[model samples]
Every structure is written in structure tokens, then in C-alpha cells.
Target: MKLYYMPGACSLSPHIVLRELGLPFELERVDTKSGKTERGADFRALNPKGYVPVLQLDDGRTLTEGPAIVQYLADLAPEARLAPPNGSFERAQLQAWLNYVTSELHKSVGSLFNPSMPAEWRQATQQAIGARFDYLSSRLAGGGFLTGPRFTVADAYLFVVLSWTSHVGLDLARWPALKAFVDRVAARPAVQAALRAEGLA
Candidate 1:
């Protein structure tokens, strides 16, 4: 498998999962602005969406979207228990967390990245994100991973999104549980390896 990624981007989630699962894969860095990869291949040909986190499988099939990619990788090694069995109630709960992270938290935090966004909108977005964070803080108050004591694909997704806080000038300190969650996930060997590989550590 080959994972096309942009350093420190959402792709990092699957990248971490790959390492956690001990899967063999190659990494190709994509220059999103230039529409090219490190090997000079046109990225649009691989994923027309023009984004990172594109996973090319052994048979040459490709998978896009961070949530889908991570779940696919996790299911490959069920014994790793990175995700619950499909069609199970726990799996549905995991899906809920993934959806919330992507649709609610990811989108809200991402909107702040647009330099042209108006000040009023940015403030409003921050407040909206704060409310979401409040809920997460409460959910995470038990000091366990989202969904339970065991870490899953949802945790990987959440960790990557929360890592974006600093880049957007949003402080995680306001949410103590979320901040600690970041710290705990960051300390994981797989996550650390991913960070170092991406030049983020």
C-alpha cells in the first residue's frame, strides 16, 4: 500500500494507524499547491478531489477520506482491535464519533484556516468550536479514549483534528480533558513515529 500525504494534515490519522497496525506501506509526499507529488506525479490523477490521505492498495485500488481509510486499515488487522467489528453496536458508536469529528469539529476548525474569512465569522466559528469542545471535554472527562477505555480509529481521527487547534490559534488549554487526551495520544509510539516521519515532531 502507498499513502499519499501532506505533512501534518488529516492524512496523519491513517498514517498513524498504519504504523499502529504494523502494516507495510510506502509514503509519498504531496505538494497540494503544485498539484504534484514528491515523485512529480500529478496528484489529481490519483485523487481528483485534490486532497491528501489517498491510500493506494496492493491491487492498485485507491481509498480516499481519512475516516474511511483508517477504518479500512483497521479492519485489515482485527486482532489489533483498533476498531470494533462491523455491524456491531460498538462499531456504530465509533462511527458516530467519527462523523461528529469530521462533520462538526473538523469543518468548524477548518473554516478558520481561510484567511479571507471575515472577523465576525471567525469569532462565531470559534465560539461554535468551543461549544463542541465543551461537549468533548465532558465526554472525555473519564480520561479514557472516546467510546471506551481502549483506543480505536475514532481516537486517531479525534487526535489529528485536535492537533490542529494550535495551528488555528485555538488553545486546547481551555479544555483540560481534550488537552490531556492529546498528550496521551501523542505519547503513543505509533503516533510519535508518524509525527517524526511527517517532520512534525
Candidate 2:
């Protein structure tokens, strides 16, 4: 499998999952702005949406969307317990968290990265993200990962979004549990390997 990604992008979530499962895969660097892969293939030909985190399977199939890709990889190695069993309540809970992180956290933080975004809109987005952090910090205070003691794909997704805090000028320090969550995820060997491989470490 080859994962097309940009350094420090949301693609890092599945990259971390692949490592957690100890699956053999290669990385293909994508220049998002240029819509080109490292080998200069037109990214739009592979994915019309023109985003990072496109996974090309060994069988010549492709997968996009960070949430779906991570879950697919996790299901491939259920023993790793990166996600709960399909059709179970626990799995549904994991999905809920995944949806929240994708829509509420990821989308909001992503918008702030737009240089053309208005200042007032940026301020509102920041405040909205702050509220999300507040709620997530409280949920995290009770827990060991989003769905239980074992880390799930949801945790990986959240970690990638939280990582953008500093880049967008939002301080994780303002929410200690969320701040600690980032550190805890960072200390994981799989995450460390992903970071190092992506030149983010």
C-alpha cells in the first residue's frame, strides 16, 4: 500500500494507524498546492477532490477520506484494537467521536489555515474550536482514549487535529487535559515513528 500525504497533514492519522497495526506500506508525498505527487503524477487524476491522505492499495484500488481509511486499516487488523467491532455499540460510539472530530474540530481548524479567510470569521472559528476543546477536555478527563482504555482510530484523528493548535495560533495550554492528551499521544511509539517518517519529529 502507498499512502499519499503531505507532512503533518490529516493523513498522519492513517499513517499512525498503519504503524500501530505494523502493516507494511510506503509513503508518497503529495504537494497539495501543486496537485502533484512526488513522481509528478496528476493528483486530480487519482482524486478529483485534490486532497492529501489518499491511500492506494496494493491491489490497485484507492481509498480517500481520513476517517474511513483509518477504520478500514483498523478492521484489517482487529487484533490491534484500533477500533471496536463493527455493529457494536462501542463501535458506534467510536464513530460518533470520529464524526465530531472530523466535522467540528477538523473542518473548523482547517478553515483557519486559509490565508484568505476573513479576520472576523477567523475569530469566530477560534472561539468555536475553543468550545470544542472545553467539551473534549472534560470527556478526556474521565477516560483512557475516546472509546475506552485502548486507543482507537478516533484518538489518532483527534491527535492530528489538536496538533494544528499551535500552527493556527490556538493554544492547547488553555486546556490542560487536551494539552496532556497531545503529549500522551505523542509519546506513543507508533506516533513517534509516524512523525519521524514524515519529517515532523
Top candidate on TM-score is 1
lDDT of 1 by residue, 40-159 (tens): 999999999999899999899999999999999999999999999999999999999999999999889988889999999999999999999999999999898999899998999899
Q: What is the model-wide C-alpha lDDT for candidate 2?
A: 0.93
Candidate 2 clashes between residue pairs 3 or more apart in a chain or in different chains: none
Worst 10 residues of 1 by lDDT: 105-114
Q: Quick one: RMSD of model 2?
A: 0.9
How well does candidate 1 match the true structure in TM-score terms? 0.99
TM per prediction: 0.99, 0.97
Model 2 per-residue lDDT at 40:
91
Q: How many angstroms is residue 50 displaced in model 1 relative to the true structure, after the best TM-score fit? A: 0.4
| Candidate 1 local lDDT, residue 69 | 95
lDDT of 2 by residue, 39-88 (tens): 99999898999998999999989999999999999999999989889999
